[model samples]
Target: MLLDALVNTTDAVASTRSRLAKVEALAGLLAQLEPDEIAPAVGFLLGKPRQGRVGVGWRGLSAAMGAPAAESSLTIADLDALLDRLAEASGAGSAGDRSRELGEFTALATEREQDFITRALLGDMRTGALEGVLTDAVARAADRPGDVVRRAAMLSGDLGETARLALTGTAEELDAVGLVVGRPVLPMLAATAASTSAALETTGEASVEYKLDGARIQVHRAGDEIRVFTRSLADITHRVPEVVEVVRNLPVRDVILDGETLSLDEDGAPRPFQETMSRFGADAARETVLHPWFFDILHVDGRDLLDEPLSTRLAELERVAGAHRIPGEVTADPEVAERVSRDAIEAGQEGVVVKAIGSPYAAGRRGSSWIKVKPVHTFDLVVLASEWGYGRRKGWLSNLHLGALDPTGEFGEPGGYVMVGKTFKGLTDELLRWQTEYFPQIEVRSSAGTVWVAPTTVVEIAIDGVQRSSRYPGGIALRFARVKRYRDDKPASEADTIQTLRALLRE
Candidate 1:
């Protein structure tokens, strides 16, 4: 239950990819922990605190967190005492008394704990060590994949399910029920084609659809009540009130639809994702702002559409979703698919995710099943996990490693997978806090502060082209990889594969 114990394990899990093996390792370690340590243990690895970490941003807030336990205290326990005092202050204290009290507390806490608490409150621990990694460690201990554990964790809203499962054996019961996105159905794998002819040649029957640039959304509805979630299952119902209202007004009462929530300019061109996210913070977002475009329905009335193909869902989605239409459908013709991709790009959108008619909405699965072919304009890549960001980059995430799926092994891997390069750009003061908190979590095995992470984050890697490499994991290195915008829409597993990067070179 010591904070260090949990922190250490989190470091271990972030580096370990084998979820099943992690579970075994954690099971042994968890058995030694006390019951009281359970929630804190879970919370830490989960990338949060048991008592939601007390954060301090303002100098006043910083002062309170840094306040010493007493004249002689220096431990985190002392900081906790200082924070506890914040919750106990009386309003009767005049402004002068309040200022004095604040000053006293700030001076008492150690500089280290004070800074840590300050960033914690801000909630952007850019530390490569993140809760997702801890979730993976917990999942590994549970004999499932970290993602499987994360899906289950998100559903339960609890991470301690790991220890409980180890002792009681109920964790397996939950994992048995996969967190499906839409209708419960096995996901169909996708076929890759370097060109339109190549794509059509593989599928005996071919169909293509306009790949909108927006966050992939899956909705589950019953009557007027509906839950709008992201492909990752994060409840976005609150973030996209406009879409929720649209869902409530839909013609069908009971239905589940799949779609994208795009941010568009007056011309209907997709806006930058950051702009779309910023709008969510507006008071008007609740009144009216942002747009919802539904494209596929996985369930309608009382029937499930998993057995049905993408073609059937598109038709049904249009009918039930109303205004939500399949943007544009393309015939299986390779030349036509290419034309559509070009048009989407010229229209100022990111690129396209060419979905076949027979595909299923694969929940928690990333394959060619649903693919993203981005615009020639490379999206930005943020430095996620770095080794020292070092040398001149020391103390920063120096080397930028980028990832995206390679439906083809053009980059030479089984799938296109590669780590771009190190970057010294796109970092901010706030980002420094993030790296400080997060990088430690993802640190595979580190000495002092120097560390490494399993290349698991997707950075919009750009380049003149890729070249053979002996230093990087994907066998190729980016020419001049630097920080771009941080992406939350595209998950790490969904990052460009080495093969996909190869075509960029070929082009």
Candidate 2:
């Protein structure tokens, strides 16, 4: 198929807000692809390339730019081959070679194709064709159930391959794609709850496990060979040999365990999250060893336990890795659940996760089967600046610059606020318009897309937690921040202190 056809379909998909329209457009495009082209076509439509990260940055792309071709002549096969060559380039003069190749390739693409290529290369396909929409499109085109398609995609951890199999192969073949011993599958995720009592009321007879403040690890072992993967399914077997050795020592011949890994202090308490991340990202650091704590098992021997309930999986985990299991219990009483949550917090852990006893594993997506309850801290913060919006939010003030009161003058001028992070989430159309109208009245300066305002307007913001950072002057940043409302009655001096946020990080 010609590359223009796919680009045109992507444009159509992005140009609409209706879910049905997007699915129809994607299904129509999928129907026209050949068997061998289905995988790459789906990848491109999803705003991803088969060859990952070809070392092409904005500077490289800008330097390689040439005038677009008057007509479209490039084929899907041709584009895929060019990307393959670019991904394979390395060593001496690789940057120049990549730039030359990108220039040659971009010169053959039309203007619309160039626009699509830029977004795809930048990993920002902003198209409405996200994973959920594309999965529905696949089901519609293949005459299969959405659940079946989702399971195949999650188990294989590759939507493009799943698309190809669903379109060209039989349903039985798709179902046969089970968990391999050394291959990584998408880990299950948890939903959030306001409190443990509410979570227990929703999911009766629940298992409340301590939510650790560490990185997620999925270990796959078969005899002496062992492989470890992160939550996003990145293979990191070489970085942590200690984890590999521990999994290799398990009694089971073949097993897949899902757990968390973190560094512990001399007192056996979990280290700071920043320290754990630093150790996790290191290529080789044998001095600081990471300990693994298993919570669930996905597979044991040749039996696949993914279809089993949480109780069954826990039993299998106890038999295989009882020594490394996290602390938890099964109960329906809200009082017990709250007690466990309290204990977890007292032990310097994050919080507790309440899970339904009979729910099977839902991979790659956050479902309500398992819910987490953590202490949410909200503070009155100052809005320093705002940025222009895009897409449906165009012509409006959207993303806000959030600051914490720095009273000690530790970072800069006396009584001046310090920037922690920026957030564009949890804003409705009314809030967007309100900011667009009210912010300029307090504006101190304006730029091309951003407006700087006096730090007099205080707004209430909620955050999951805080993390240590070097990018901001205060040395801390918020996680999953969202605006609750504008605190018009509060003064800048009454805003939350930088010390308060940094204290949360220490917890």
Off by over 4 Å in 1: 1-4, 7-23, 30-43, 46-207, 226-239, 272-274, 286-288, 302-309, 375-380, 384-419, 422-464, 468-507
lDDT of each: 0.53, 0.82
Best by lDDT: 2
- Give candidate 2 regions above 4 Å deviation: 377-507
Report the C-alpha lDDT of model 2 over 333-399, residue by residue, as the tens digit: 8889989999988888888999999988877766788987776666668898999999999999999
For each of the candidates, the C-alpha root-mean-square deviation to the true structure, in angstroms, is: 8.7, 12.5
> Model 1 lDDT vs. the true structure?
0.53
State every prediction's TM-score relative to the real structure. Answer: 0.61, 0.77
What are the per-residue Cα lDDT tens digits for candidate 1 across 353-428? 5676677665434455554455443543333345555455556644444554433333333222344566656555
lDDT of 2: 0.82
Q: What's the distance in Å from true for residue 137, model 1?
A: 6.7
Q: What is the lDDT of residue 220 in candidate 1?
A: 74
